[model samples]
Target: MTRRTVVADTRSFRSDIQGLRALAVGLVILAHAGFRTASGGFIGVDVFFVISGFLIIGLLLREAGESGRISILDFYARRARRVIPAATIVLVATAVASAYVLPLVRGAEVIKDSVWAAFFAANIRFSLVETDYFSQGEPPSPVQHYWSLSVEEQFYIVIPLLLLAVAVVVRRRAGEAAEADRVRVLRRTVFVVLAAVTLSSLAWSIHVTATSPTGAYFSTAARAWELGIGGLAATLVWGRAPRLGRWATEAVLAVGLALIAFATLRFDAQTAVPGSAALVPVLGSALMLAAGSTTGASSTYLFRLFSIAPARVVGDWSYSLYLWHFPVLRLCEEYWEEPRLSKPHLAVALVLIFALSAASYHLVEQPFRKGVRWRPRLRAITLYPVSLAMVVVTAVGAHAWVDGQIAALEDNPGIAVSDYGRDGLSKDPTVALVEASVLAAQDDRPVPGGLEPALGSVRESVAPLGDCDYRTGTRKLCAFGDPDAERTIALMGDSHARHWSPAIDAIGREHGYRVYVFVYSGCPAITFTRLTDGGRPWTECADFKEWALGQVRELHPDLVVLANNAYQSAAMKKRQVGALRDQLELLRPLAGKVAMIGDSPKLPKAPGTCISERDVDLGDCLQEPETGPTRIQGQFRQTVEDLGMTWVDARRWFCAEDRCPAVIGNVVPLRDREHVTVEYSTLLADPIAAALGIAEG
Candidate 1:
């Protein structure tokens, strides 16, 4: 009822926690800034999770202890005031900046990402997309960092209710017990619940990280344990400090800092994270908090060091810094068209990030969080829905504007569409015509008006291989073309091979042949021990390849088609060429004929994005062909040809006179930096069939 017990700050503020916040944000910034030593700096987010769990649950527990009940309204009001305002500003600002600075295709993506972030569902959006946070080729969404905040918000929503439920159940069970005993029982019950959650989530995190690393990285279920560990620590050291000696407390603090440092320096993009591996930083953070909660721990040198003026200042602004850095750095990279920012650009970006964080902290975060003196007490809580509505409106506006721009580009009179008569080098007239159109468009002409799979939707224009079983050793095929056709052909490889389905399906239908698809996203059909993006051995790929080959042998299809991106074979040492030859030899005995589609020319940028950004002079998006197939690709080609298997020279179809245009026959060739769009792949059917010497129906 009084000021002391009305709010949840029943415990005194710990400046060391502020220092930990500074540390967490620093690690994340350094990692994202491309500091090689801080490669594992992503663990900083795990540290933050631990800190949030400790602070939030501690607040809830303290309120229940002092006031005999928890005010869910007050808890949510504090969260809305402290979090929503600053987050909304970042979301809106990032959306506006993305529309102006990013390519039109990426702009659309950012808008969608912003909408998800506004609703506090950014993690869900990212998980659904299977966004590999560590991916080298794809640009991170501007709002990607919001995923961590989303996780925390979700935890906040549930933790209060959970604590309240525990308080209610304990009071009911202890109706005649003293107040002291009632509070004690409630805390103990909550501790058990937190422990159960921690262990179960940790187990799930390890399993999911192994099976589906990308999704696991963004999953709340996989990450809840980190926060639970923090909550458990808070519950253990709630009212009284740990009774350890000063020396013991200092030792705990030192070990905690060491663990954090080790993870920051030793971890890299290849580490499967927020799993068992994440325990280092999560536990380290919890230990640091727990150590400070010990008697006389605040006087320790480690605590004093963390509480220093500079560290505390940075920590105070840490939230704004985290929100602003990712979008600023990402957009800078997009502007410069460099995967890594140059020194000057990097320096400029740092300046801008700090300046913005400081301004937002003072002008937006502090003003709103502290509340206006004249405003009604409950008015601030309305910010939750208001901020969400503002962000959604911004996203909707951005989406419509992008669509309008694409439509306008499509209406340009200079654009050409001749119904794409097939004629050129391939026996298939359509393939030849498409190639000729591509070559003609190179170094000239604006993007054609009637671009297939309009630029706005091109990024999602991936071939549909959703029904195919990507992991199993068993033959689970997604059939295409005439299913009842007498003749049969099987397509097998990685995503690159999968993209060829549209074209393959067309060829199969024309020639009265049935098509069976067997493909996985990152798994190559090659027989080498492949490392996943996380640097772990990919045994599933090997298993699938073996089973697919065995099935091919049993069925002995009329034709077997194979292709894979060069990245799959990048890890092969001296055995790349040998591996291909061996794979070919195995296939020769099983299939009537074997053909390998050479990996497509690697584009410098995403074609849809390039076209969207340079529609006025589409020639700007033309790629000057590289020397030839990469070393791995060349080796695969030579071995396939040497083994007498048909090797399709795909470059001729995408490039001419050393110039490869982003679009051919009014079609965007690729959905992203790699992987052909289904529309363009469908156009390549005749060329592929001609190369394989397959007769027309």
Candidate 2:
């Protein structure tokens, strides 16, 4: 193994370059911590990309003509020593901390992040993770910044080896011509990679801007061109420049610095394509490097600025600072339930980042880098597994614990469904698809208005003044719908069917009809069980629907009622109606009456909290409404109506004249993006009662 040492000519290295690194990384730190002024600070990463390209290319050129072997083991060993120690420490600690802090679903998400970080596949991870980037006012996980490191390291793995191979081939040919050919080959590779990367970035940026801008901002694919641009500079121009007059070089150097400063101040998160925006700093760095390496006077001013001692120190610590800042920011954000972070919080983040990075650099990074001083086998063997085990154990254990609770909730979806982020989302004013649909039902436009929200209802359907367990799959538990019960009525369906209950329950008490409801979460009162994942038959859903219908007939329900959102699609809606019809056909003979409460507006996409629901960041929802749900609702409505299901149209009911409020008349309409809030759902009681020919709830 060979150790690559800094040469005696190290003084020739520009100290201002390190300062430049400091400035870039500092911008990233501030930007991520939610400093509004640092909105353009994300361009710092682009600056770093250029710097990396310059430095790596310079290092490769230093050994370009050397005859001795380039040790792959040593190269990898240095990389591992520099990166794994601090990264693993953070990963292990963060994993354990997250197990306790995050909820079941969020905990699972963090574990996936941990696995990606451990393997240096964070770039790949970021590409797949669907989350907002600029609005990252939410707490980011510790592993989030690892994506940048992954890209650098992955590039390092290839670039050095490729350069080494080029050197070897050039030596075998043993001529200036052959060396030139070798350089050409290397340049060709760079050009090809750059072209591909740029094109891909352009395409992705356009797509994401049009479709999912937030995702595009965070995705590595959309950002790769920044790095590729630097790589192109390295291959095409870095070492081959001709000497220029000193004053001329200084002028060029000054211009470069001016460009970087200008870009730092002007570029921001919302800047689109960023293709040309990023070029300003990268090209600036290239010019500065060119001026210094050449005998040109144009670079003198820039070189002098980068040669300062303080600047060098900052550059030395820049990587460590970058690593430490995001976690500190995230901690504060999580603690505060922050949407917009305060300056004091950002300052605290900076303080924490500096303190930790300094401590970590001296204690962990320095010692490990001294490969000759330390016992390698001891450190590698003891540190590696312990660090890895910590991450794995913490992640897996936390996942298992969270999953167990989730599984329990899944098994008992009745009361447990209310526990799933309902309170958090409801208290927040953000509009999820469910909330949007609920509000849409209140619109002034003429909806085929039959149902309305029954506010201030305290009605219960369980009666004979006693409790009964109808939760069993096969057994039917009879509880009178009201203490003042007379004629029996039955309500049967999935959650959609269950939603009609609030009003029906009030109406049942008022009209002397005992409305007994048999309900399931997603397995609406439909007969079809074919809509399932994993290619498995859900015979249970089919049976539950069938048995509930049978019970309605045997119990001699006076008014047989069946209902669901008819908007599911003609084929799918027909299946749902067929199930409803089956129940109606059976009950009509026994009850001598039947009514199918119409379907509510359905959303196309599953409502997920687009923004943090707990923090109550309704600004984004109010600012840019999500259309996935409304579109799905249109499809669902068309399908259901096509099936000829007697349905109440909720489109006009939920919306205002044009804009629908997420919360209507002080009611939060959704638990998540899909399901209605129990409190909000209860509001529907009155409208249902009025439509059922009973007293207004």
Candidate 3:
């Protein structure tokens, strides 16, 4: 295709759309910056999806309408020019900043995330990792915002091919003389296709949001409907939307703005989102776009306001602003060790964000878009191969570097067992002795060679045995520690219980007892009903708990060890305590002895990410362990004591008299915010066995 043929649609400025961009970006910034009123400002991303669909689909339809065919190469080249340059600059810069500001272990993960973002596959990577977008304990990735961009890029890739196919079929049927009829047929066909996709995607969004809200948030399938809604609008009424009277335009604009405002102010992280709730913002945005398109120059005051220079200027910088805000906010949070910013600090950060956005928009984004000629021949000859090579090289290099670091750590035996206090183990172990050893080894500096090597090895040490580990639905029994042994000790509960397996299994092996691992992800061992994060009944957990109770009775295990991370809302504390009482009462009659381990200290942040060798002091990363018994722990102890069962308070092993150190005896204590590292868990074997009345071998 010639340059003239490909460039059939000239770019025209739309002040209203630009204003919408500004509003969307502003809401997102406010929301991310911890403004209480903008809790639902995250919906701004949904607004962007609609706007993108409208603009991109409009261009393709216009091109096909004029030339009777779409230039695939030219379309891709235009996308590359518009998206890649600024994204690359931001990705590289974020990677460099992460290495300096973040812990080495976390920095390695960010590098991987940056590589995924560079290839516009960050959404897929995040989904694979099951990263919780709303999690508070885990530090957010600097490039987490790239997930939406990835979804949009994926849409761009698919939509053009679909439009081209529709155009081909329309032309083949109608012939050259009936070009107008062919274009009309293509429009109708496109509208029908978009409508179907919209409904299908909406259904999927609702279903997925109900079943798995976190997954739904990052899912392309769940988000596609929003874009399809915009595509439908473009196909049906690009330039020919019916003109509306001033009164009607004003009403539409008023209602649209109100809906968006309600959603922005009312919705929060706990709100079910990307489902029916998302329709508030999506439909509101569509209404605003429709009204803006139909309103005349002398129409409504709202239309005039949106067309003003200030909104347009912000709109011009909106893309860069959105790109810059999250990373800047994340950096600020990392430095301060706080999620919320003070007013003065927030104001300064916003100023910095705007300055950086302006520089990126002018120096990187606008320059590349204008200079890069999107001619079909040039793009096919140069851009595609070069872009693909950059993506491949970045991803491969990052993966290789992380792998090498992990491998070096794994090969060094000294690093694995360093400062473990193995010599301190005694026949009669106590929490006080464990604390003494840890406190004795405590140092201001981070572990030697940083914590990445230890953090990387953590998973391997605690990972459930092969295929025997139960991940979903019901429980699967995984046996360890001399399976042929007559005396069986059962370890039960969710991942909190699973974290203690390294020590428990070691104890079982030494004692000539078989250890049966029966744990599920996120499912606690409780008698009362519980809900998943998505607000559905945790049926699998209930089912597994019931089944395990029966199995324990049948097997007549010599000992049953129970544990759970019972940190929950104050409202549920009473019910959770009651449930613990009920579970303990039931277990008392089934096993020879039932022991309940108290929950570990829930750290303010992931220890791996919080502790670094570069820091002058540990700072707020070291928190004082709660002096009094936790409400749940107190309840558990009371319930177990009432049932005449064993109750082990293991908190002293994790925290000392004043503070809980992130690293104890050259070992990072936590794999994440809540789970203890296997190396540390192994250190607790003697103390735990002592608590269980198990004598040393």
TM-score per model over all chains = 0.90, 0.57, 0.86
lDDT string for model 2 (479-580, tens) is: 544745768778776666666666566667666777677765456655566443223355556667667767776778766666554434344654654554
lDDT tens digits, residue span 1-697, model 3: 0011111123445567777788989999999999888989999998888877777788889988878789998787777777776777777677767766766567677877887887788899888777888887577899999999989888777889988998888777778657667777888888887798899999999888876677788888999999888777677665365568889888988898898899999999988879998999888887777676663523688877876888877888888888889999998877666678888888888999999999998887776666635434466336545655665566556545544544444332222222445454432334444454344435333243434336545423454555556654435666787777899998888888988888888888888889987777666777876676657775656777778788888888899999887757653565877787777778778788999888788765666665432442344366655433365677778888887888888777777665676665456677776787777777788778888998742
So what's the TM-score on candidate 2? Answer: 0.57
**Better structure of 2 and 3 per TM-score:** 3
Q: Lowest lDDT 10-mer window, candidate 1?
A: 1-10
- Cα lDDT tens digits, model 1, 140-242, are 9989999999988887788898888887777678888887787788788989988988899999998878767888899899999999998898898886666
Candidate that would win on lDDT = 1
Report lDDT per candidate: 0.80, 0.56, 0.74
**For candidate 3, what is the TM-score?**
0.86
Ranking by lDDT: 1, 3, 2
Candidate maximizing TM-score: 1
Shift in Å, residue 185, candidate 2? 9.5
Give candidates' CA RMSD values in order.
Answer: 3.7, 15.6, 4.7
